[model samples]
Target: MQKILITCEHGGREIPEKYGPYFQAHQPLLETHRGWDIGALELYKKLVAAGADASFFSETSRLLVELNRSLHHPNLFSDITRQTAEVEREAILEAHYHPYRKQVENAIQTFISQKHSVLHLSVHSFTPELNGEIRNADIGLLYDPQRNTEKEFCARWKQEFEKLDTGLKVRFNYPYRGTADGFTTHLRKLFPDEKYGGIELEVNQKFPQGDKKNWEKVQQIIMQSFYAAVK
Candidate 1:
């Protein structure tokens, strides 16, 4: 048997009320891609909306703590948050980061424990322009090129997506490296090639906010193609 899990690491831009003061002048930053992945959480909802048997969840904000990063990763905290005391940063780690990672890790562990092959899709969105660099990909599927199962799955997925919309730009391992340190990458350490496949799905923020109908169409195409490929 096989299963799918969808998750959004940078979901919302919420700074807990207790820590709101720390981000006083940075409220606008929260609204932008830096704080939380624009449209990622909402898109997560759409992907799993059909009641798929997926263990899905959303993170509050990347600014508070980067859920994608490992325990010792330096970029876990943004510049503003890096200024906080060690105790405060540890609190953020304990309060939010670890639990989220454990939840995902446990989900995979449980599925594979039951002798099920798992196909996990960690949902995310990237800014169109970052530091004056324009990102041309409309959708990015990130998976380890060394993992033949994952690599082939993404290739078939991209083909299916392009079949739906010929003009849609689907790239593999664009903007960021697929094998980069992330939740999926961490899971790979525990599960071998036969039991697990992790792919990070990155969509451009423009679709979610740019047009109402187009966004919905893109959402539908993504879900449809994903199902088709996995089937």
Candidate 2:
């Protein structure tokens, strides 16, 4: 069955109205990569076009609340300023974070109820170099090793991605290890063992330049690789 679902949490950096001017004041910091996960949304769209049912967060900026990060993560917010007054922060979490999570949960439930095999592809992008250290891998397939389903998916993706472009480096569980926590945590717990499988696909930023053309290329690779893995 051609069943698939996709999502991208750090797709954008849209600041809420109350915090808009404040972020603008610190334009340099707010516009940096820290504010958004650069290029993730575009890749999600590609998956959608390739026949996957894709759900995405529409917040104006990730600076308000990082939809991808665990709600308890300390640095979810860039910094606390007057713009992030107590009331504003509460509202941001209530409106942005909760709704996005609800959407993901609902999608998972709907797919399972329909008796279709589900592949929850969480799309993400990472900077090639962090703290001045170069990241040599082109892609990272994150999956909890304890889960046989995730382990098999990750292994298959690694092989398929390399076949698409042998020069592109592909690794399993590098940069960050996959675990049943954060957004994927919710899905893993909600769905039954055999019906659902989740994979956090992390792409290095060197290829996708946050532009339309480059985004298209990244999207193509993801869709193709995902199709191959599922097969």
Candidate 3:
């Protein structure tokens, strides 16, 4: 069987030198949740070292493109005016988005050919509050209705995570709902016959930010839970 494959689309939030000034002016917003999920890449690396094969997109600019979002999504930019610059948008899409998606597709295909059962895990982080209400959960799992595998995986994951930390607040399908055309959606559709599983994990940023000790603690807990699930 093939080992599990992990991916983090919004791993880093870095503004390239060319876009540094723009980001600097809007630091409050750009550096916030709009840029990248803080520490997600660090957690992803830990997962990779724990024996899971991982892949991610690399870019030093948030204004460029979002690896997780579909290319056609208007949210690709911080503002719609960015679309006016056709050349820049095209360059960002070609250089970042396309390559990232292609890498994931290739990784899945490679493992399938080896006759391994593939588990797809996408890592992300969420803000404690959106609009005005505070989100009560510490973790959120998103899954699409078309793929029942996501539901099954979330249930198993929740059980494992809760065992690691009894006080941990975990929920199934909250914060963001999985869409049929999302990255996970595309991959599941392409590999319907494989023992394909999809999981979208959302960690509340406050936990890690408030307590450095808790950050590593949660990372270890997640790694252990994932290892158990795949093994």
Q: Candidate 2: where is the Cα deviation over 4 Å?
A: 81-83, 210-218
lDDT of 3 by residue, 1-231 (tens): 755778888777666676565555666665677677876778888888888765664544455576666667766666722734788778767767788889888888888787876788888888888899899888888787666666777777888987888888888777777663468866777887346777777888897677889888988998898787665
- Answer with 1 or 3, whichever has the higher TM-score: 1
- Each model's Cα RMSD: 1.1, 2.5, 2.1
Summarize candidate 1's per-residue lDDT along 1-231 as a digit string, tens digits: 988888888888888887898899899888999988888877788778854567566557788889998877899899989999999999988888888888888888888889898888998999999999999999999999999879989999998998899888999998899999999999888899888899999999989879989988988888888988898
Better of 1 and 2 by TM-score: 1
- What clash pairs does model 2 have? 13-60, 13-61, 13-62, 14-60, 14-61, 15-61
Q: Going through the candidates in order, what is the number of backbone clashes in each?
A: 0, 6, 3
TM-score of 2: 0.88
Q: Candidate 3: count the clashes.
A: 3
Looking at model 2, residue 68 earns an lDDT score of: 65
Question: lDDT of all predictions, in order shown?
Answer: 0.88, 0.74, 0.74
Which ten residues in a row are the worst by lDDT in model 1?
50-59
Question: What TM-scores do the predictions have?
Answer: 0.97, 0.88, 0.90
Off by over 4 Å in 1: none
